[model samples]
Target: MHVPDGFIDAPISAATGVVAAGAIAVSLRGARRELDERTAPLAGLVAAFIFAVQMLNFPVAAGTSGHLLGGALAAILVGPYTGVLCVSVVLLMQGILFADGGLTALGVNITDMAITTTVVAYAVFRGLVKILPRTRRSITAASFTAALLSVPAAALVFTLLYALGGTTDVSLGKVATAMIGVHVLIGIGEAAITALTVGAVIAVRPDLVYGARGLEQRLKLRVNGELVDAQAPLEPATPRTSRRKLWIGGLVASLLLAGFVSFYASSNPDGLEKVAADQGIDQKAKEHASADSPLADYGVRDVDDARLSGGLAGVIGVGVTVVAGSGVFWAVRKRRSTSQAA
Candidate 1:
């Protein structure tokens, strides 16, 4: 939810910082098992796409809007550990480059948004897939249910954090009720987005969807009166749409969404911002440290044309996020290869 500075006290914020760091450390190791040559690049693109979709905030209530949180979408498309890294990269870029989320509260945002959402979404997804049919439809259904629950789970986590280190003396019960109540509406949007995106990827390249993998049964044949797995062709036929083409298409979609479509996003405050303002959570909120950055507030400095400035900022954000995310994933993949060789 992009918690801003001064919303949580120094001690609690620092504690969350430690928690975030530890989780990242563990995820880095875990990602090695998840990322290989085929999926590593796709993982980076997933991060960039999440960054783009997050810009298009949809109206949720009278004054509140919501955006794709990306945890369930990423976990379903990639894997849980890499999903955490994907969201973390977006948060890092937004904090340092866009001045959107608070630098001081980075840990709080990661813990609530990145860690909690990914863990909960992936867990729910796994549970549903285990019980449901192992079809693409079932995977999509699980993604929808997982995403729907993840948003409120994140809201509940934020409520707990605020209860412990809230700067204001607001009623805890009221805050929880408002936060959970509104986020449930937001969760519906999240569910739709996650399901549609996952279903699209599964349709095109089910091989690339981590959650859909292992669902395809090998063709069985009767040979010499015995049922046996069909022998794979020595030279596997090329996929109609190559991974390179998929990556290019995804990047183009991200560019379109962020560069132009975001202009139509509801201008109302998001769920977090609306709740904070209504609950007096922002009474002690401090200004973002990067507020003066050229790209602050998702606009280029001195770029008078609102459309052009925002478009440039969005494009730059997508470009930077892709490069950074790819770099991280590539390095992780390299480490995996080196260790295997050893």
Candidate 2:
């Protein structure tokens, strides 16, 4: 849920801005441990994919809709720190380029959507993995549970933030209940998508899936009445395909999700917007600074056909987000390389 401008007072907003900035700085350092030769490029794709899928708002309740918050998916595919950066990058792109969220409330959105979800989901996922069986099914189940809980956690955090500096005089209890209720429904969709995506990646390349790493335990096989440990799948196969193809495939999927599939997304207010209106939280919401931009609101300027305009905008968004996110990751990777060289 993107926090629009004037939702929280200036002081609290500035505080959250500082918190978000610090978290990003720390995550950058942590991501170095996560990003290497193979996963570095995937990090960028993670951001692009998140941006693309978020455009396709699925129906949640009767009139409300929900989109991919993407923290759990990114954390499961890449790493938690990198996941935070991925979602943060998407939020930044949406705010600056598409005018989807407000610039003033950028920190709030990042804090609520990126930081909260990643932390909570990753913690839950890792804990479940430790307790459950070391199989792909377990990983997928954990991913689903983590994603499910993460949405409500984010909603609760957002409610707390709003209570601290809410612009309107709304009942805190009502806001909390509505936010949690709607987001729970949204969470179900989030879990399914996250589980499916993680399962897909794990099926093809378990090594590339960050959460699946180190889970390559040998299976026992009975040979001549003796228990023998069989070879795990982590080893590179003889006909091992280059990771470049997978990266390219991911990029193509991202493009299709944003450029084409998004056309069919539900055209209704998301859970946050619906609750904000219902609870009067959006009473003081201000217009986004980029509202007058040519490509504002996910539509290309001067494009007559609704489909074409949105498609073009989505394509452009994916391109920009991938480029920007790749630049950040590549720079981080380079810094690591230089340090190791020294």
Candidate 3:
């Protein structure tokens, strides 16, 4: 959920800002180990894909909708550290450009939505992968379970944060109950989306999916009725061109989703918005600072056609997020190379 301004006080907000910054700093270093020539480029595509899928909010309840949080999906496709950066990029783009999230509350959104989700999801995924069979199906299953739990975990973290620095005097217990209940349902949608997307990628290019790495069983050959390990003779390692193709394909898919398919997303309020409206927690919600931006509210300024306006805004968002995310990841990749050289 994109927490708007005035929901949390200045002190707690600033505290979260520090925490978010520290987390990003740590992730930048950890992502160095996760990113390589094959994964660095895909990391940017994963961010763009998450941005696109988030635009398609699906109905969860009678008046509530949910969208892909992307933490598990990104972590499964790339890695945990990179996943945090991916979601952070999307939240930043939405806040500053689309006015979807508030600028003042950027830290809250990043901490709760990006950091918490990625940590919890990746932890669960690793744990499951350790116990489950090492196969693509097992990886997908683990991804689904991790994604399902991450949403509610994030809701709980937010509720705790609100309890500590809530602007209103609402009952913390009631807020927790409502937030967790609604987000649990929302997590089902998150799991399905995460599983399907991870499954699709694993099917096409398991080599590119970080979570699926080492999950493939070694092939065996029958040599004169004896089973023999299929190991190739020593040869010079070939560069991965298939990964580049996959990255290009993923970027194109993200463009298509945001540019055109986003028009069909459900118009109903999302899980957090619905809970806030019902729980009276949104009483002090402040206007977004970027509300005056031309692309505010996911619509182009002065575009009379609802479809065209929203479509253009979505496309612009995809473009900005990809550029921003790619820049950050590319820098991280460069630092990684420098460190290795040193």
C-alpha RMSD values across all candidates? 2.7, 1.8, 3.1
**What is the C-alpha local distance difference test score of each model?**
0.92, 0.92, 0.88
TM-score of candidate 3 against the unseen true structure: 0.93
| Residue range 153-243, candidate 1, lDDT tens digits | 9999999999999999999998899999999999999999999999888777777888876664346799899999864432224555789
RMSD of 1: 2.7
Model number with the top TM-score: 2
Residue-wise lDDT of candidate 3 within 215-317, one digit each (tens)?
A: 5444689999999977542211453347767777888888888888999998999888888888888999999899999999899999999989988988888
Q: Give the range where candidate 3 is weakest over 10 consecutive residues by summed lDDT.
A: 232-241
What's the alpha carbon RMSD for model 2? 1.8
For each candidate, give its TM-score against the true structure: 0.94, 0.96, 0.93
Error of 1 at 107 (Å): 0.5
Please give, for residues 1-342, the per-residue lDDT of candidate 2 as tens digits. Answer: 888898898988988999999999999998988999889999999999999999989999988999989999999889999999999999999999999878989999999999999999999999999999778999999999999999999999999999898999999999999999999999999999999999887777778899988876568999999999886764345424457887899899999989999999999999999999888899999999999888899999999999999999999999999999999999988988988899
Error of 3 at 125 (Å): 0.5
Clashes of each: 0, 0, 0
